[model samples]
Target: MAGNSDPLTPRAKLAVTAGKAVAAASRAAGRGSGSVIGGRVALKLDPDLLARLAQNLDVVLVSATNGKTTTTRLIAEALRAAGPVVSNALGANMPAGITSALAGSSEARYGVIEVDEKYLAGVARDTDPKCIALLNLSRDQLDRAAETRMLAENWREGLAGSKAVIVANADDPLVVWAASSSPNVIWVAAGQMWKDDAWSCPSCGGVMQRPGDDWFCGECGFRRPTPSWALSGDHVLDPHGSAWPIHLQLPGRANKANAASSAAVAAVFGVPPQVALERMYQVQAVAGRYDVVQFEGRDLRLLLAKNPAGWLETFSLIDPPPTPVILSVNARGADGTDTSWLWDVDYTRLTGHPICVIGDRKLDLAVRLEVANQQFQVCENLDQAVQLCPPGRIEVIANYTAFQDLRRRVGN
Candidate 1:
């Protein structure tokens, strides 16, 4: 599965050529943010470039409120066994990122892309992907994404006649609801830890009964779907109930679910589950996340906490007492204008841990921590905050822009 290095159609080639020039200019002007502007220019030149590039190619699209970046990375890494793959390695999930990734690797036969949740339907329809991994969707970037129910409904409609085989998360009621309409689906019980978003049945608005790991609507018969692939203890059970040992270098239980979701797709592509997990085990970071690097005088490990659901998982992964952590936040456009989601997280989890708040929303976070009875220090600069931490590997957890800012400071 080597890349298709051969030139494309005349129009597409010309568009790419123009795009490369724009990208070069952007870089020279120090405004180039990865392949963003370049891709945008190419797309502007040839509006059909994405769809055209996707033609006659094996493409897999992964979308979710959180974990899409890591999950896409896992899928792409696993597909390496199948040979050449081009992907959004920078964790850019928008159309520009996808366009840039595809335009550059014209020779690639397989494309593994992480799509923004809001752009799923359009991208999926245009790309005509072979497999669509529908991970759990929660309330993320509400200022930009609005209601989760609306997104789910839109996705259901978008995938109504999709020819792609949907790799679905049966454990997530929202994911199940959105993907159930798809004709061809492979269900995976990847385990949903964040139940706040799917507490009620999306169908009848009835309270979902969660007596155990299983969830069902009392009014309507909607319930967790029977999965062909499920996470049972340390093993992932195949449809035949054969247990496949699951292990990942990626931290948090959420990552385990991410790996399971990816394995389900790899199976559809004929890549064995073991082979997928083996390759995924080598991925320590996606973009700048889960990376350990020296900053200032202390070592810092990065974690991107985008929403309440994501923060819950990250909170659990933090080191206990005596360990210091730097929590950075920003209310930038990319991070969503509303920072209210911070109150939804159980910040009490850091009861005894020392805290250092940094970023644009440092004061807001400081207030949140104080109300939670957690003591903290406010240091907006990452370098100054790093100097304040005790002699140990510090956990630097931040929201979108803050994380990117910290990543740049770490020279990552």
Candidate 2:
């Protein structure tokens, strides 16, 4: 019920007020961040609260199997060059959490939401966003979420006839298939790290032909689209053939690809590429991923990788051998209850590094490492893991719940 030109209905106003109170209480009680719980309460009272709060706002929905949180943060930072922006920057990418984020700031000019792959269609329908940035699609939480092609088909069907501009990754064939139905689409050549899930064509179920960086279906002739935005070594080539250098405090090529996509999404709002890149450089971390924190006189750098595709990209972010890597895994609900995805990741990349494993599924990771012929020690907790290493910078890569556990333990 914060004041706006188009005010919320009385019922929606009451719902928002109650939701805000619940969020405040939850935070005060040290129970949780309260976004999800508060949003659930609000929706139970007024089911249309999300739509009502999103009215008159330029919303951007970001979805992907990986990098969506960071990309959403980057996009939100760039959009701030225009006006006030509201975002679930803490990685709450669900309907309830998104609703709580929007309801909290009723007068914001924009809403940038990170949405789960399974929930994008519903959120898009409610928010009626101005832009939808489809980052990439791969096997993620498969025990809960559907297959990659099925998710892509849902996106294609859900977004059809919608007026939102689709900013999609040209390098990811699944993303291309998902965004193909949209009339207004801007394809950016954001590099894809894992191509295992996209081997077969979604259209004709034929083998996809990849010649260097290009991909085409052998049966139906569905081909990779020419991207308007392309990323070179350290620069992004805009549609006008202008090269803009992407210098970010965030490390890795994945971040550069994310920045390239963010610039393209911001362009739809009239924000220049250089300006967006400048703003994006200020973001040091997103929702504790890649956050460097001090714990027990040691610098612990936290990295979150939930799936095989994400783990492949995260492996590059780790420090070189002898730096000592701590790998943690969990099979909690947030993380799919199947640790079998661990076998898909090539843990042999950590060879020569002093590796330690810790989590609910630490034994599974230990077995995977053993199969890779990599030496590792299983530790009960982060404290024990850190004790094995000397007092210096240590890399801690963990799955979803394990990452959250470390964040709490390290006081991040």
**Scored by CA lDDT, what does every candidate get?**
0.86, 0.92
Count of backbone clashes for each model? Answer: 5, 0
For this target, which candidate reaches the highest lDDT against the unseen true structure? 2
Model 2: per-residue lDDT, tens digit, 230-349?
888899999999999998988898999999999999999999999999999899988888889998889999999999998999899888988999999999999999878888899889
Q: Look at candidate 1 and tell me the lDDT of residue 35.
A: 80
How far is 77's C-alpha from truth in model 1 (Å)?
Answer: 1.0
Query: Cα miss at 212, model 2 (Å)?
Result: 0.8
Cα-based RMSD of candidate 1: 1.9
**What are the per-residue Cα lDDT tens digits for candidate 1 across 302-351?**
99999998999998887788788999999999999888888888889988
Per-prediction TM-score? 0.96, 0.98
lDDT, candidate 1, equals: 0.86
TM-score of 1: 0.96
